[model samples]
Target: MPEGLPLSHAQEALWFLHQLAPDSSAHNTGVAVVIRSAIDLPALHRATDELARRHDLLRSTFAEADGRPVRLVGPDGLAGLEVLDRPGVSDAALRAAVEAALAEPFPLRERGAFRTVLVRRGPQDAVLLIASHHIASDATSHLVLLRDLLRSYEPAAAGGDPTLPPLPGTFDDHVGAERGFLASPRGAETELHWRRVCAGAAPAELPADRPRSAGTPFVGDVCRVEVDPEAAARLRAVAAESGVTEFAYLLGVFQGLLYRSTRQADFLIGCPTTTRLSSKTREVVGNFTNTLVLRANLARGSTFRAAAVSAAEQLRAGVAGIRYPFPLLASRVRLSGGAPLCRLTFNMLNATGSDPLLGLLLDTEHEDRVVPNAGLLLSSLPLPQLGGELDLMVNVRRSADALAVEFRYNANVFERETMRRLAGHFARAIAVAVAGPDSRIATARLWDTAEPARS
Candidate 1:
């Protein structure tokens, strides 16, 4: 939380990415959390206006007026917010209002890069809706924005002064760095490297479960899976016995799940990195995140535990070298310039604060705002907590009337009940390997389950 450092987060990283690839469509994603309180609407608007004024980045938008990307800094007058007052509205009605606002096509060719739709859910509840274009926002940013807005709201409450920091750098600085990098010698080498990596390698493509549409769709769903204390203890024991990172064991379990769900051995999955490599810009807020891909090579005879270990090794190395920007990688590996390398990103979010007011002054705070089309498999449950029960959320896309599922399982394949039963199966398989390194993955469960022992 110290402002003395120079490390950057995903927000700053994304800004740099946009500067490198202004036409990249994978940049949009944000979210809105409905907070219900008997707060004054006029006061809230004033606060929002004030908030926008305080942060230059929030006041700016991505633009291409002359066919060159530029920051469209917002006018102080237009920073005002509006709360749609709809009293006596049901949940369905509230949803309808949101849907209508979402349905409004984003005017990206215009000046600002984002939009806000404030709707009243009830006398006490209101929706602080944010609709930001992909190039300028993402989920992490959404959270930051919310935290700040709420903090700023308190001061805007009593007409008191809000404390805000002087931004050491702007989004433009990120773009400038990316631009310079892209034109440098390292940039050329990186592009060539990427071309070879992706060359002749088959793309991980998901078959459409339904009809394909050219229409821009934003369908999404969330599934929550928690690992309780008892199970987590077993997991820890197994991980220790196997001599691998807990994350590696978890990835192995996920690969098994993916194999069951998708029936594919190889997959391209992305996880997030904090991207704060140095101390100079540590507290500097912006998109400082990048994606590290895990390509699992599961085969018919591969044991679940082996897969986990393999995954762990890959992650350890990948996480260490995450300083490499993925946009640059795409250029390096010489993949199609327009298409992103990976689609399904397994984002293990690590941005939650230990202290709610970690680096905030009483006068100002930042909330988590989001970008368009963030990622799947994004969950943020801090490590080493609770009855071993940990929370995991599977986030997928859907505008409305869609569904998502979490394949739940205990650490025993036979005792598990899933169409694929991969999570349960892999857990048991890996646990055995942990308990006995040389044990076969197909061997019986190392631990008992709700079901009786298998013959």
Candidate 2:
């Protein structure tokens, strides 16, 4: 190990949790890129080594300083690679192997926090697992890593150069730049902005199915729904008519769903925003994500269009301060008991179209079609929930002609059917709201089972 840079704000928060649950892999973010074609082991090994060398953070581990966390970037080499043969195994077994690879905990204080496991079912079928501690990676970072890893593998397979052009700077550069900003007057303004956003905000405690526990089990269960394509198109038309982004309208609809279901007039939800405000940081890999909390007051008789417009405005303002670190914001608010500032988190990827990272990688594929082409399906392993910091998480992705929404809830707090019904309410609410922005939010229909006592 060599001397290294300070951890980014996002990194520090996750590192704190990592320290608290050193045995849990709930914080692990794993990406499995399925390759239906044969894999070149030696070439992949070479590419793996190159990728770790390229992103300093990928080869880094954490340690505690006097009172804070620091990242120790390791010298370049093969980070970690494990190859397993799974010939003739059932699909269940193959899936289990992939999940195990992802759930395996990292030796954060001693070894690099990133590793790759290749589970080969046949010469033409295998799954490539890229697992990294959340502290060292994010959705965007994984995309960068996947793109670079595939690119590196292509040429190495052909015995061509695997070396990538050096990045303008490392993750340390980003940490330094962000720290400088926080120490300036601008940082004070950022804090004030958050103060205004969070004042009088109550945590989103949507009536849970079970008693609230002192310690959140973080056990997660998922419920999925696919927005009817025709309905999605209608909503898109509404957004266009209102001159607001589709995401703005969808977010408003989500808020409306919560309001109609829980009968709460005011509450908060959050969406993760990338902190990479500069092109230079785009290619750098690290935990550069911040959660942006938006407070919504669903006044009686408020039209969906008005809500959409309000949401769009708040979204713009919230993103403007995306550079503000979430951990610091949590502290400034003086929230205690390790309860997350916001209980419901929503993220919309593919807002423009396909996944941003996949879009970038697809473009690269056009230039170099010779890479070991493989069909990649990104999925989350159905492993036991490591535990959750939040009560609910909703992820929305736009597909060919519809929006797919997945609701992940704390199993201890929410029954699987509870989440399932919530998903139904969301889909129905969006469909009804799309009829026109003037549609009353209360008109969104739901079963009596989910209706709440008026708040």
Candidate 3:
């Protein structure tokens, strides 16, 4: 085997974050599935080992080489499958067990970044849990791993060969390409574009119910709300009429909420962008996410339409400069000590129509199969509770006729009731913005009465 490979820029940032909070499980990415059929344990184990062998990042550990972090791949890529039998266990107990397993920390320096557990509830019922450190996996990676795991399991279960497709490129090749880009003229231009875009932007100061104290832990909870079919349809229609993507329209509404709450005309909101530019890396399992700090400038007399248009423009510019490293941009802006460059993030996931993961779990096509030829019904388990690293994170999942919105916030910085109210405010903002796109952002109603007082 060859020597260790250098960590990518995204991996390096996650490595430092892990060092800062070694016990924090906020950076762990996980997914679970409830299998309605008796699983072949030995076959599943073999499939898992095959998955690790195929993806080097799954079998790799992070360590410092000459004061810089490097990925060291082991010879055997086995992340042993641990099976637990709990016959007649209550639903609450089963959930608790799965949560505990998901929250288990990974000693990335000594062990591989992947883990798996099987909780057998009965002869024909079980749950499969998969987790990996964010340094080695991401949202897209979870889907890739699941597809490959099941693809490998079917053959192993039948005592036949698993003919998986050849990987187009390895994680090491990605790292090399990233390094090459950073040294190229295009990379320099991209960095310059970001620097100019983020100039004079301050971290958003969302009015929290409680003030954050020094050394406060990064604990968080999620509050979810659903937009009615009528409202969701109106929102899509408005976005289409205004010649902007749904993401831009949603982001505009979020920016308006922040502006009304903080009364700040200019601030920053982080948006995660994928760094998988080439088709070769489409299925690669690693951290290929980069944060793009979108500057939301709501002028004094701007209307919601103007805000949405501005958001659309910024999104275009940001995606064009997505190749610029986030860590380098952070350092260039001297955003070291006080507060993070962006205190809020907004993400939009098209779940109902496009996302392959949700499509598989929900069987959106009514195909009656998660994995072809596998006679098992699979449903996605709720994601395990974990800490958050942001002041506020908003995620919107678009379905056929409705939009499901979830706000994940730091519990220490916000009360449950505050988050509830915030969720309501978000819904109202969307309704108002879509109903009257030209309404002045300042005059848009967020509360029945005056806004709540900031702490």
Task: Report how far off residue 100 is in candidate 3 (Å).
Answer: 0.7
| Worst 10-residue lDDT window, candidate 3 | 364-373
Ranked by TM-score, the better of candidates 2 and 3 is 3
Mind giving the per-residue lDDT tens digits that candidate 1 earns over 1-455? Answer: 11111212333344555555454433444455555446656556766766577555556655433333445565675445755787879877876776555445444434445556677756656566665544454444555565566666666667765545554555446545655666788757655544544564433433333433333232332323333334444655676666786557666665555554455666656665655455533433356566676677777666757777888876875665565577556544534434346645443322233433222111011223222111111111111111101112222111112212233211211122332333344445434544554433333353356644332
Candidate 3's residue-wise lDDT over 1-455, tens digit each? Answer: 24678988888988998888878788777788778777778788888888887888877888887788888888655576888888989978887888878888888988868888888899877888888888898878887888788889889888977657789988778889889988999988888888787776688877777887766777778898877667788988899998999999989888888888888888888998788889999988998888898998887688888889999998998898888878778867754255667878899977666555566553322333444234456766777446456888888877665687888889989999888888888888888889899998887776886755421
Clashes of each: 79, 2, 0
Clashing residue pairs found in predicted model 3: none
> What would the TM-scores of all predictions be?
0.66, 0.91, 0.93
For model 3 the local lDDT of residue 356 reads 52
> Relative to the unseen true structure, what is the Cα RMSD of model 1?
10.6
Superposed Cα deviation of residue 15, candidate 2 (Å): 1.7
Deviation of model 1 at 368, angstroms: 20
Please give, for residues 33-72, the per-residue lDDT of candidate 2 as tens digits.
5566767788888888889888887677678766777877
Ranking by lDDT: 3, 2, 1
Comparing 1 and 3 by TM-score, which wins?
3
| Candidate whose lDDT is highest | 3
Q: Give the Å shift of residue 333 in candidate 1.
A: 4.3
